[model samples]
Every structure is written in C-alpha cells, then in structure tokens.
Target: MNTIAHSTPVAIASARTPSFSPWRCYWLEAKHELLRLLRTPSFVLPTLLFPPLFYVLFGVVLAGGRSGGDMGRYLLATYGVFGIMGAALFGFGVSVAVERERGFLTLKRALPMPPGAYLLAKMAMAMVFAAIISLILAVIAVSLAKVSLQPAQWALLFAINVLGVLPFCALGLCIGAWVSGSAAPAVVNILYLPMAFLSGLWLPLQILPAIFAKIAPVWPAYHLGQVALKVVDRDGGGSLALHLAVLGVVTVAFFVLARARLSRSQ
Candidate 1:
C-alpha cells in the first residue's frame, strides 16, 4: 500500500510535468532550422558565397589601388547589409512558403511545438548566416582591401548588419504568407535586387538618378545602409530618428499583414 501510494504521487507528478519544456523545444527547433539551412546546398551556397564574392570583386579588385577614400570600408558596410538581407528573405521566404503549401506547416502546428517557434527558428538561422557574412567581409576588407577601422567600429558595423536583417524578415514573412511557393522566389528577387541597387547597396544612391536618390529613403535597405555607413563615420545625412522610425513601422506593419494573411489561409 505504501509502495502504491508512492507510485501514485510519482505518476501524478509525471503527468503534471511537461514532456518537453518550451525552452528546450525552442532550442531544438532553432537547431533543426539551422541544420536544415546548413545542409541545403542551394540555400548555403548563395548565402555563403555572394557577399564575399561581391566584396572581393567590387570592394577589393575594383576598389584596389585607391589609397585615398575608403571605398572598401563603404562597400563592406553596404554589402554586409546586402548579404544579410538576402539570407533573411530567401531563407525565410522560400522555406515558409514551401512548408505551408506542402502541409508541413500544418503538421508542425499539430505538434507540441510552441506557436511561432518556426518563425523564431528561421530568424535565428538568418542571424547565424549574417554573422558569417559580416565576418568574411570584414576580414576581406581589412586584409585584402586595406579598409581599416577601430575594433569598436568593426563591432558596431557587424551588429548593425546582423540586426538589420529583421525588417527584411518581416517583409519576407508577409510575402511568404501571401504568395505561392513558386511565386515567392520570383517576387523576392524582384523586390530584393532592385531595392538593393536603388538603395545604394551596389553603387552610390546619388549616381542612380535624381528620382532614385529622392526615393532612396523609402527603401528599408537605405535606412540600414545609412546606419551602417555611420558606424564608419561616413553617414549620408539621414537622421537616426528617421531610420529607426521607418524600420520600426515597416517591421510592425509587415508582421501584422503576414499574420492576417496566414490567419485567412487557415
């Protein structure tokens, strides 16, 4: 009877305790998403290759022998933003759309996982990719391109690039929830590359056109670029207030729209 009584309490305690804690689940899910990204050649290749490649070509080769102004420094910040933006958008956007269409999202939802864990996992993975891109670019800039900055400045630039991926993640979510799997890639590319160029990720915003320069602040990447440039003391005269406000508004609006679209689909 004592043994039975002890067994009964233990059984009750086991029933009360969760099979898996939320934090544990979150960690596992995030790790799973990171692994998924790492294993996929299509995802890993472009995200890993493009930023460093661009920096080596434009920020290094073309930027070579120009010992005056720090063009390499400029490209480092801008291309860092460019690289993170691509990783966040394509990683989250394509995967989210494909999962939803394949019913995997529904399956994940049916599991014991917390709601939005999948989204969080993708964001975490995007940050990981952003870190790698920033590191590679910084190394290339310092070693090959001779773009030097104080250690603190390098840290600041890296942080800016990593955090700047958030707004694009929201935009990606909005696009993913609204579009089909096939359409998501084309839509993302169309929206991404042009905005990067027009936002001065490739060339100066001033060189684009009068109209393009005037509208540059409208692009999220432009705000990110401005902040990044300021890290190395080469800002383009944008107010910090405007940059923060614009990114905050864009993030909130896009996330709300994505959630609404997802709700409707269900």
Candidate 2:
C-alpha cells in the first residue's frame, strides 16, 4: 500500500508537469501565435500589403515624381512606422481579445507553462511582423524609389521600426484587456488611423494645421515618427532624448495598465 501510494503521487506530479522546457514553451507559444496570424487573411493581407501599397502610391508614384528621392526617403521612414503600428496594434489587440473571449487564456493559465509566456509570445510575434514590414519598405525605397542613405542610417531606421512596435503592443494590450473581442478592431482602427494622420505618416506635419503640429507630440506614433525621421535627418528639430523619453513613458504606462487589468480578470 505504501509503495502504491508513493508511485501514485509521483505519477500525478509527472502528469501535472509541463514536458517542454521554459524556453521551449515560450518558443512554441510564439511560433503558434505567428502561424495563427499568418493564416488569418484579414490580419496577414492588410498587415503585409497595405503599407507597401500606400508607399508605392504616395511615396513612389506621386512623391517620387514630384520631390524626387527626398520624399521617398522621408516616406520610407514614416510608412515603416505606419506598417509596424498596424502590425502591433492588430496582432496584439485582436488576438488577445478573441483569445480571452474564447477562454484560451484561461486554458493557458491552467497549463504548467510560465505565467508570462503568453504575453512574451505575443510581443515576439509583433516584433517579427515589424521586422518583415521594415524590410519590405527598405526594398521598395532602394529599388523603386531610389532613395539612398548611409548604411548606418538604414540599419538604425530598421532597428527603430522593430523596437517601436513595443509601444503600440502595450497600447493594444490595454485595449484588448478592457474591451470585448468584437469591439477591439473598431477601437484600434479608431485610434490607429487618426494617430497616423496626425503624426504625419501620410503627409508631413508642417503641411497640416498649426494645432495638429502642436498636438502631435501627444501621440506615441508621433514620437516614433520623429525618431525615424531623425535617422534620415528629416526630423522636425525635436530632441532625440525627448522622443525616446515620451515613447518609454507611453510604453510603461500602457503596459502597467494592461497588466493590472489582466491580473484583475484572472
């Protein structure tokens, strides 16, 4: 009886343990998240195609024809920011809301994996999408638009896009935590489009009204856009330290809010 009891406890503990190592669990989660978004046409098509299409239309065809390579280089930075914004917002926002509604989060919570693996997976997935978008914009800028830059500039701009996705990811997490799945897309779009425009992702802020230029700094996208513009020496004379500080604060604030809400729900 004693032997049976001891073996029974051991078997139960083994059964409860996760088979995968910690890093492996995180990797698998991220892999599946990327695959899931890739398979979703609504997500994949727009995230991958829209920025390039917009760049081709505005940056390449029109702007390149008018202002020559300068416009292309400018738009390259802006549109790269735009592409990453879309990827991070939709990827984190919609997926989290839907998964939460579907009880997937609860299921994962019951599993034996690390508590942060799910969120970390989503973050990694967003960065991957951001990287792809950045590369595509680089190709379009170099080949079609013929915009030239120093090697370090190109590398810096790409790094900005990849890391810049984090703020939007945090904002998306905040929206997803607070809103229902059905409303998540609408909520994101409401903020995304307006912010992009006001931040001069489509056109330069100098062309916009005075008020918009004044208020542009309030949006995290504007700060990111400025940092990106700095890479090409086209920024609006804002301090790099100021932009980075604003972005850092925005990221931390949204992430804290989202984490609090998620913990409450749990």
Output the number of the TM-score-best candidate. 1
Best by lDDT: 2
Q: Point out where model 1 deviates above 4 Å.
A: 1-19, 67-69
- In model 1, how large is the Cα lDDT of residue 242? 90
The residue pairs found clashing in candidate 2 are none
Q: Model 2, which residues run further than 4 Å from truth? A: 1-20
What is the alpha-carbon lDDT for the whole of candidate 1? 0.88
- Please provide TM-scores, in order, for all candidate models, with all chains considered together: 0.93, 0.92
lDDT of each: 0.88, 0.92
Model 2 lDDT tens row, 190-264: 999999999999998888799999999889999999999999988999899999999999999999998899889
User: Residues 86-184, candidate 1, lDDT per residue (tens digit)?
Assistant: 999998788889988998888988997899788899999999999999998888887898887999999898898788889999999998998899899
Give the count of colliding residue pairs in each prediction. Answer: 0, 0
Alpha-carbon deviation at 175 in model 1, angstroms: 0.7
Evaluated at residue 34, the lDDT of candidate 2 is: 90
